[model samples]
Target: MDLGTSLINVALLAMLFVVAVAIIRMRSLFAIVMLAGAYSLLSATWFVVLDAVDVAFTEAAVGAGISTALMLGAMLLTSRTAKSERAILGVVPFLVCVLTGAVLIYATIDLPALGDAASAANSHVGAQYLERVQADTGVPNVVTAVLASYRGFDTLGETCVIFAAGVAVVLLLGFGERSLSARSDKGRSRKESK
Candidate 1:
């Protein structure tokens, strides 16, 4: 189990890295959104292999599902293809990404390997969610207890973010329709003048 899950986790982590590169390289906004979703799914798999089920579920929901859906919908409402240029994002994003990856790797170096007995994550507040949830928050199942009681505020914040995204998408949908029509009209006039 250890070797199998470790391999899966590492493979998914590599996929996440590749998808990040692909997202940057993709020319279509729709393709970029889809690649972002693939990255999220890979990250969720990594979280699951690291035994962080709660975080994985949240990431899968917001990142892979809702966020991706909204982004793709917005892309469809906007441009069919993204504008391409030969320019890169300067050097800042690459530098920041390298620094962040280095920091994460350095931080993990001292941590227990996956499935290790001394894995502090497995012995943390998650156990309380499983064992003493009825006493702690009056819920029997740990998932329900955590979502309903412990992290209710965080979920509410996520809901607010989704609501804001919906509003923004609505505005973009209206504006994009108008822009598309105007572009079509201009194209027709240009051809007629020719």
Candidate 2:
């Protein structure tokens, strides 16, 4: 990658790391949720810089937008601040996280350098798709052609999964007007009895 692109990537990654640390350290539910959304936004920006606009849009919409809204609604049903807890329980998780990160970094050592033309990802199948996508699919944009034509079923499955998950989240978050009205009626009955 060019120096400018590398610098932008580094800056976005640094911002993401800072937001993650803030989320982990904060005790207020509102602050943590906001920070998590910000982290997702930064991740989306990073994806854009890496030339993955579609993934970036998905991350921004689902990760930052829908998720933040859901969490904010859920947050309203509970206390604003989390209860203070001892850090003793966190040590094991922290150690596990560090070890996992180390292993992941080691695994990447074998991967090809970024944007290497000869890398397996850029050769053979990818080249073929680029060359033949227009002829086969009659789509001007290769990315759109790949997603809509070649991987149509996979895309549809993903859409269905996302829709189901959104429905499940709404149900779990107690957005049912019937339940709210029932709880209020019970409270009114108790008040009237007194």
Q: What TM-score, computed on C-alpha atoms, does each candidate reach?
A: 0.64, 0.81
Lowest-sum lDDT 10-residue window in model 1 = 169-178
Pairs of residues clashing in candidate 2: none
Q: Pick the candidate with the highest lDDT.
A: 2
For residues 48-151, what per-residue lDDT tens digits would candidate 1 score against the true structure?
88777888998999899998997876676577777787876769899999999999999999988656755787678766566777777876557777776789
Tens digits of lDDT, candidate 2, 74-165:
89889999988776767889999999999999999999997787899989788888989978988888889988888999999999998998
Q: Give the clash total for candidate 2.
A: 0
- Predict model 2's lDDT versus the native: 0.90
lDDT of 2 at 120: 98
